[model samples]
Target: NAGVIQTPRHKVTGKGQEATLWCEPISGHSAVFWYRQTIVQGLEFLTYFRNQAPIDDSGMPKERFSAQMPNQSHSTLKIQSTQPQDSAVYLCASSLGAEVFFGKGTRLTVV
Candidate 1:
């Protein structure tokens, strides 16, 4: 298996632009998670999907941040109205029971 695949290892967008990060989980995995990492925040859980269904998103911002698992193979994290504060490394992970695999992550930079 290719493990979890995240496209465009890095992204750069202007403030107010939108950035969408993509993730492809391992085959048959039932759970996926999104996290954001920053110098101050360390790693913060953003959202989670179980069986391609959204289960939690309490850590996500109230506006301009959203995550979707459209199918068993992939998920997407969208960030709109990008700001300098939004610049961080977005990580994707998938799990089967106890074992988990993670992608390289997408580093988003807003200018």
Candidate 2:
């Protein structure tokens, strides 16, 4: 079990550009979740996948946030037309239930 993996630990994007973050969940885990954390928002759930299928994305922005799981090992979150307000830590987590593990997170800075 690799726990969780997130890449490009940091990202900087121009306002109105796009940013992509990646995540790899632990082996044999069937549930994956995405979250955004900041001083203002605390932690907000962006989306979740169970058994490689999207379960809910109510917390995601209707305009620019998207998440996907193409396989059992990995997931991705993409933000388009990034804005300064979008700057935050994007975290990915996985779990079976009641016990979830989080990735180190990708810190995004939109300037």
Q: State model 1's lDDT.
A: 0.94
In model 2, which residue pairs have backbone atoms overlapping below 3 Å? none
What's the number of clashes in each of the models? 0, 0
Candidates in order have lDDT scores of: 0.94, 0.95
**C-alpha positional error of residue 26 in candidate 2 after TM-score superposition, expressed in Å:** 0.4
lDDT of 1 at 51: 98
Per-residue lDDT of model 2, residues 62-96, tens digit only: 99989999999999999999999999999999998
lDDT of 1 at 6: 96
lDDT string for model 1 (1-111, tens) is 887999889999999999999999999999999999999999999999999989999999979999998889999999999999999999999999988788999999999
Clashing pairs in 1: none
- Quantify how close model 2 is to the true structure by its C-alpha RMSD in Å: 0.8
